[model samples]
Structures are given as C-alpha cells and as structure tokens.
Target: MKIAIVGATGLVGREIIRICEELLPHEATYTLFASSNSAGTKLKVNEKVCEVKELKEENIETYDISLFSAGGERSKKFAKSFLNKGSYVVDNSSAFRMEEEVPLVVYGINEDKISKETKLISNPNCTTMGLVMVLKPLHEKYKLEKIVPTAYQAVSGSGRAAVESLKNEEKLGEELKPNYRDGFYTRPISRNVIPLAGNLTENGYSDEEMKFVNESRKILDIKSLIVEPSNARVGVETGHGVFCSATFQKEVDVKEAIDVLNSFNGVQYWEETLPTPLDAEGSNDVLVGRMRKGLSSNKILNFWSVSDNLLKGAALNAVQIASYIVQND
Candidate 1:
C-alpha cells in the first residue's frame, strides 16, 4: 500500500506517521504531506528521516489513502478532491462525520460500515471513540436506553498549542491568562478546569458535548438514544477520561455485563497489559475499568474509559478505518 498522511507536521498527524510505520504490513511505502510552511521540515518515520511535501491538488492524486487531522476547513476543502481522484480519505476532522454519505467508524465497534463506495470515512471524536468501545458491548447485550457522561479531557485534545501552554505555565508557576494566538486553549488551561470545549451553540451544548451525544448515536445506530454529557477541559497532557452512567432497556446482570465487556475487542479487562495513554501512548485500543451498577436504578451502570487522544482518538482510528477499507473492499 502507498499511503499519504496529511497534516504531517501536527501532533495527531505526526502520530499517524508513527502508527503507519508501526502497523504497516511488510510491503508498504509511506509519504508525508504538510502545508507549505512546513514543507521543508524533516520527520523520522521508522528510523528514516523524511521531508514533508507541500499539499496541493495537482499532487494529491498519487496515493491510495490519506489520513487527515488538520482541521475541518482543510478537510472540507481537500478531502473530496483526493476522493474524486480515487484516494480513500480517512478523515479525523468533524467536517464530514455527520454527513449522510460519510460513515463514522470506530474500528472494533463498526468497521463493517466501510466499503469502496465509502470514500470519505469520518473518525469519531476522541472522547466518543473511547466511550463507544465500552458502550457497544453493553448496548448489544442490554440495549442502552440512556446515558449521563462527564468528560475530563486533556490539553492534547485542543492541539499542539495547548500542550505547549501547560509546559510554559509550569515554568512560570501559576495559572496565567489566555493569550489568544500562541495559547491554544480558549481559557487559561494551567491549574484550573475549563467548563467549555469547542464553540457553544444555540442549545447551550458546546460542539464537543454535541459530538458525544450525536456521534454516539450515529456510531451505535440509535438515533433516539439519550446522551446527557458535560464536556470539560482538565490539565492533563494525554488521555481523555470519561465518567459515564448509563441505563439499559432491561435490568442488567452486573456479572454478565462485566464478562461481556471483558470479551469485547479493544477493551482492557482480562489483561493488565491494556494500554493507557502511557501504554496506549502509541497504540490503538481504548482502556476501561472500574465498572459498577448504580445503587438505585437496576438498569443503570457506571464505568471509566480512557484512551490516548492522539491515537485511539484520532490518528489510529483514521489508520484503522483506512486499513478496514482496504481489507474489506
């Protein structure tokens, strides 16, 4: 396979490069693409230093697949251009996720949705990807009815600027004020938690919150499923931890639920080896643990799920989708 990674100089894009090298089948060639500003920059992929190339329409038709994490606008502008040229676009942006034509896929949960006709497949939000892995097995057995989720998302979810802000803030000592450009977080992300993530819409749900509610339904194929989520930003470098309480259609057997979750792919129940941000640091699985039943509602349950935002959340998911397309098609 010949692969091209767009946004190659960004954090998630860089991780995609690492994953491609780590997961490549023995016979494969990789290419790195970035904006002109980063064109001459050099990156090390599988021990070799490769220079980034400028991304232009004329040069976009040379690869079999493109994994993108640049942002919505860049994807909106160029994804179809690549797809039209027969390059499968596994997008990591929010742009095409909800579109009727695009399939929002999480590799273990719903990889079969992919096909040759599905040119631009959207990867779900990082938080959604981690949560759905745990939810899918339970939903399949008990039929999830309602969910209340609160996310303690890390600074890496905001992008490279937020990661650097925490480092700079650590040097100075206290929580500083937000300085628009260089500081990626909208508010001071140092020693405090920010209640907001993404833009706030008319319904009062931040775009990040809506992604959890909306994308969960799409991935689960349950449009009427109720998901109440509070998305917040915390001062962590990696890993988005979600504290979720969910209700099922029937009273779930706690032991059976636990056993089923333990059996699910990408879940970390039986093996202590399941990756966390540090273990999943460069890998693809979502880590889950500490499951319990709500004392009051027979149908309700609680659990914690964590995943490296750059990997399971973005890059790895994109690559997994691309790999699924190739194998299944």
Candidate 2:
C-alpha cells in the first residue's frame, strides 16, 4: 500500500514517520511531502532513505492512507485532494477537527466513529488528547457534568522553534532577566512559565484553552458539557500535563476511579506517586496520578494527566487513527 506523510520534515511529521515505522505494516511504502524549503530533505524510514517532495496540487498522488501533521492552512488546502484520490486521511491539525461532517476521533475512546466507508479523521490537540484518555473512563463510569483544566504544556508542543527559543534563552545562564520577554512566545520561556499559551481570543480564552474546552466536549460526545480551561507554556521541552477537577453527575469513588484508570489500555496510573514532565517524556501512554476528591465535593474528581506531546499527543494518535482505518478496512 502507498502511504503519504505530509509535512514530513517537521517535528511531529518526523515523529509520525518514526511511529508509522513501529506501528504500521512493514510492506507499506511511504511518500514524503513538505513545504518548499524542506522539500529536498531526505529522511530514513525502516532503513530506507526517502526524499521529501514539495506539496502541490500537480504532485498529489493516490495512496491507501495519508498521515498529515502540517498546520491547519496546509491541511485545509491539500487534505481534500488526498481524500479525492481515495486515500484515507488522519489529520493532526486543528483544521477540520470541528467541522460538522468531520469526525473528531480519539482512538480507543470513540474509535467506533470510524467506519470502513469513512475517509477522513481528525486528531485532537495534544493536551486534549491526554486529557480525554483519562476522562473517557471516568465519563463512562460516571456522567460528566463539568471540567476545569489548567494545562501546563511543554515548549515542544509549540514545535521545534519554541524548543530552540527555550534553549537559546537558557544560554543566557547568568544573564537571564526576570522580565526577559522576547522570542516565539509572548514572554520569556526559560526558567519561567507563561500563563498565556495561545493568543487570546475575543472571549478572553487562549486559542489553546478554548481547544481543550471544545475538543473534549466533541470527542466525549457531550455537546452540553461545561469546560473551563487555562493553558500555560512551561520551560520543559516535552510532555504536556493537565490538572483537572471534573464534576460528574454520579457520585465518584476514588478507589473505583483508580481501578478504571488502571484497567484502561492507553492509560497508566501512579497510585503511590505523581508524574512529572520527565517521568512522562518518551512514554506513549497517558500517565495519570493524584486522583482524589475535589474540594468540598464527592461528585467532583481531581487528577493529573500527562503524556509525550510528540508521541501519544500528536504522531501516535494520528497513526492510531490510520491504523484503525487499516484494520477495519
């Protein structure tokens, strides 16, 4: 089967290649595409060298599947072309995720949303991906009433440039200032935390914050669910974490919640420990810990959820959706 990896030169794109190598069928051949600047780059997949091609209309080709990690604009421009050519698409972008017709799927949670007849699937935001993995079991056992999530996202979630900015600033070692505000983010991102993640929308919510609110509701199939989120960017390079206080319609039991998290396939629970960014880095499963009753409420459940933004958060989730299509097909 012919497969295409759009944005093959990017951080997540390269990660998709690595994951597909590990997860997808070995007999499947890959075609790589990227922006003009990265088009000629060569990447290794399964010990074979593949050259990246410029993504353009005339170059569109048919494939059994296409894994896209390019940003929204490119997905909006080129994803349909791949679909029209009979390729099933698993997009890792905010674009097309909320469309009325497109299914915003979190594999293993709502993977049944995919059918053999379905051609396109959308991956949720990295933070939302990890959040819902933990939330799904809880929601299944107890009806979800609301979620208040404060996400501490890694710089790598913003891509390679953000990581570079953090590294470059770290070099200031002794020279770093308290008000050192510059570079890719609105404020300094080294040895510090920026309370604002994405650019704030008119409603005073950062785009990233709103994404958690919207994507969670959609993926969990709870349209009326209330979600209040605050997103912050941290100095760490990878692994996004969300501290959530979730209120459920039914009374929750801490032991039962621990049991459910432990039983879930893609989740790991640290009953005796809490996970940090370093602990969760390089891990595919969403690491969850600190389960307890929320302040003043038995119906409210609190927990910490974390995952590798590059793996489960972006690349793995996209490929998992593609794997679902392949299996069901």
Candidate 3:
C-alpha cells in the first residue's frame, strides 16, 4: 500500500507520519507533500529519509490513501481530486466535515458510518474528538438531550506558528507581539487564556465552539441534540481539556455512567484522579474523569475529558481510519 501525507511539515502532519510509521504495516510506502517552498525539504518517516514533493494534479493518483492536514483551503482544493483518482482521503481540516455526503467519523464511535462506497472521511475538531469519546457511551444508555461544553485547548491546535509564539512568550513575556504567520490568533497565547477560539460567527459563537456542537451531533447521529460550546485557548502546549454538563431525557446513575465510560473503547475513566493536559499529552486514549451528577439537576451529568490534541484528537484518529480501511480491504 502507498500513502501520501499532504502538509507533511505541519505539526499534525508530522505526528501523522510518526503514527503511520508506528502502526502501519512495514510494507507500506509513504510520500510527503508540501508547498513549493517546502517541497525540497527532507523529512524522516520510520527513520527513513524522504524528500517532500510539491503537490500537483498529476501525482495525486499514485497513492491508495491520502491524509490531509494542509488547512481547509488546500483540502478543499485537493481532497476531491485525490478522491476522484480512487484514493481514499481522511481530511483533518474542516473542509468537508459538514458536507451531506462526507462522513464525519471517529473510529470507535462511528466507524460503522463508513462504508465500502465512502471515499472521503472528515476528522472531527480536536475539542470535539475528546468530547464525543466520553459522551458516546453515556448517550447510548441515557440518551442526551442537551450539552454545554467549555474547552480549554492548546496552542498547538492553531498551528506551528502559534506554538512558536507560545515558546517565544516563555523567553520574552506575555506582551510579546503577535508573530503568527497568518495572524490566525487574536491574542497572545502564553501566560494567559483567551476566551475566543476561531473566528466569531454572526450568531456570536466562535467557529471552534460551533464545531463541538455540529460535529458531535453528526458523529453521534443525533440531529436534535442541543450543544452549547465555549472554546478557549490556554497556555498549555499539547492536550485539550473539555468540561461538559450533559442533560439527559432520563435519570442517570453515576455508578452506571462510570461503568459505561470504563467499558467504552478509546476512553479511560478515573474515580479519584482527574485527567489533565500533562497526563494526556503523549497518550492515544481519551482520559476521562471527574464524573458526577451536575449541580443544577438530577438529569444533568458533568464530566471532564482530556486527550492529546495532536494524537487522539487528530493524527491517531486519521491513521486509525486508514488502518480500518486496510483491514477491511
């Protein structure tokens, strides 16, 4: 099998290469693609050096699978072309996520949503990925009606430039000027938390916040589930943390909920210890903890979930989809 990773030099792209090297069969070969400026750069995959190529229309058909983390514009432009050439695409950007024909999938929660005929799959946003992992089991038993989630996301979610800005802040100070290449972020990301993530929509919710609502509903197959989300950027550099209060149609038993979480695939629950960014940074599993009854009502349950934004939240999930395709084939 041959795989092509677009945006090969980006943070998520690099992590995808590492995961592909670790999990994919050794017989598979990988090709890296980047912009013209980065095209000739060398990248190491599975300890083997490979030169990054400029993505072109002519070369997209050479791979069986393509993983895209090259921002939405690139994915919008190139993903369909790759799919048209018979290569399955797992896009990490928001490009095709809400498309009626595209299946927004999380490996354990909604792998069944993918079919032999499906060629393009969308990876959920980092915050949504961790949130739904914990919500899936509970929703199955209790039936979720509404959810209010507040995400404390990492700098890495923005891009390498944001990560560099945070590092520079540590060396300089919080007042450091915005140096992000694209000016993607509105404020400094170090020593403080920014309440706004992504652009604010006309309805007042930021794009990142709405992703939690829209993507969760799609992945859970719940069209009417009410989701109110507040997404924020924190000083942390790796994992994403989500705190949510979920209201159910029926009464929930905390013990049963804990049991359900423990039994769920791709999630781990702790009773005494709560998961943090430090605990989740290098791990593939979504670490869930602090499960209890919500303060407001008996029908509402509150919990915390954490996962490596780059791993379970992005690269690992995409690779898992690729692996599933290979296994099924």
Pick the lDDT winner: 2
Q: Please identify model 2 stretches exceeding 4 Å from their true place.
A: none
Weakest 10 consecutive residues of candidate 1 by summed lDDT = 269-278
**Of models 1 and 3, which has the larger TM-score?**
3
Q: What are the Cα lDDT values of the candidates?
A: 0.82, 0.90, 0.89
The deviation in Å at residue 84 for candidate 3 is: 1.9
lDDT of 3 by residue, 1-329 (tens): 99999999999999999989878898898899988889789998878898999988876766789999999999998887888878899999998899988999999988877776888999999999998999989999999999999999998998898898778776766446555333336666777788988889999999999898899999999999999889888989999999999999989989999899989988989777778999999998899888889777889998899999999899999999999888886
- What TM-score does prediction 2 earn? 0.97
Model 3 poorest ten-residue lDDT run: 175-184
Pairwise TM-score winner, candidates 1 and 2: 2
**Which residues of candidate 3, in runs, are more than 4 Å off?**
174-184
lDDT of 2 at 206: 92
lDDT of 1 at 46: 75
lDDT of 2 by residue, 11-112 (tens): 899899988898889988999999999877889999899989999999888999999988999999999999999999999989988887788888879888
Whole-model lDDT for model 2 versus the true structure? 0.90
Each prediction's TM-score versus the true structure: 0.92, 0.97, 0.95
Error of 2 at 142 (Å): 1.3
